[model samples]
Target: MRHHFSEQLDLVFDELAELCITVQIAVRQATEALLAGDGAAAERVISGDLDVDERRDRIEVRCFRILSLQQPVAGDLRTVVAALRMGSEVERSGDLAVHVAKVARLRMPRTAVPDELIPVVTRMSEIAVDMMGRTASIVAERDIAGLVELRALDDEMDDLRADLLQKIVGPGWTHGVEPAVDLALLSRYYERIGDHAVSVAKRVDYVITGERP
Candidate 1:
């Protein structure tokens, strides 16, 4: 019985690692699609979200099984709880990626994003992706300091969002109505992504410190 339980634990860890990798790839694809203005690539990311959804379901089942069968205690119990929470966070991240892809598709062909907004929006995407990557590592290693750093990144993204909005409303922004609205909406989406990454970091803090952020 002990040996069988050990084997199951190993399997649980493997599945969690694989789920994290899928999340990172999804985020990267969405970022690249936006930067390249590739509608087809953006579509692919939007469609591929089912993969993350399925992975979340599988991870939930695995966590429940480990809890029911192995009867995890102490640190092992905390690990299972953390896995459950992480699964939710990753699913939310996947949804955010889908949003990014959707924005990319909407802005293509006509070049909805203005020249002034492009650089700021692009930089926002890059920073959010980096934060997500670091948060994933924090989850894997349960690094408290890394999680703190992830929270710090939120301020930068928020500043970028503010700056982009100011540019859109400024006298120089003559991109017309449609493009202006699209740029505003895209900035909001990027800021929301940063928020979600911060949420993930908070979860990591909970997992490591056993306290809410």
Candidate 2:
């Protein structure tokens, strides 16, 4: 019975890892579509979000099953609970990517990001993607040490969002208010993606050390 319960827990962790990978790909593709102004790619990202949602639902169900059947205690309980929370984190990250893609689609023929702000937006995407990748690694490897670097990457993402906002509101701004608003939303979406990744990593840390970080 113990061995079977362990297997069930392993399956839940495996599903969470796969969900993280799906979210990471969504973030990358959404950023690419945003930068390139590819409406088709953006549409793809928007539609793909349903799969992420479904995966999260499956994770939740599995976690509940383990809780009901195995009655996990102590560290095992922490692991199951963390999996539930991490599933939501990654699913929300996927939604943020969809939000980024929607902005790209809305802009249509022209890119939403202006020429001057492209570099900052690009860097923000890079950091967001790196954070998601780290999240996937942390889940699969159960590496608590990687959480420090993941948190650092999140801080860098926040800084990039701040810089992007400053550029939008600074003098010599020729893009006007509408584009500025769109760019602001894009920055928020990317920043939120990093935030979700950090949340997931922290939950993993809690599962490992049996203490919230």
* Per-candidate total of colliding backbone pairs: 0, 0
How close to the true structure is residue 126 of candidate 2, measured as C-alpha lDDT?
88
C-alpha positional error of residue 51 in candidate 2 after TM-score superposition, expressed in Å:
0.7
lDDT of 2 by residue, 102-197 (tens): 888888888888877888888999898888888888888788688889888888888888877887899978989988999889899989989888
Q: Pairs clashing in candidate 1?
A: none
Give the poorly placed runs of model 1, Cα more than 4 Å off: 1-18, 73-78
Cα deviation of 83, candidate 2, in Å: 0.5
What lDDT tens digits, residue by residue, belong to model 1 across residues 1-213?
668766765665456556666766776777667767877778888988998899889989988988898897876677678778778877887888888788777777645566666678778877777776776676656676776667677888888888878877889878787877877877777677678767766766766677755
Off by over 4 Å in 2: none
What clash count does candidate 2 reach? 0
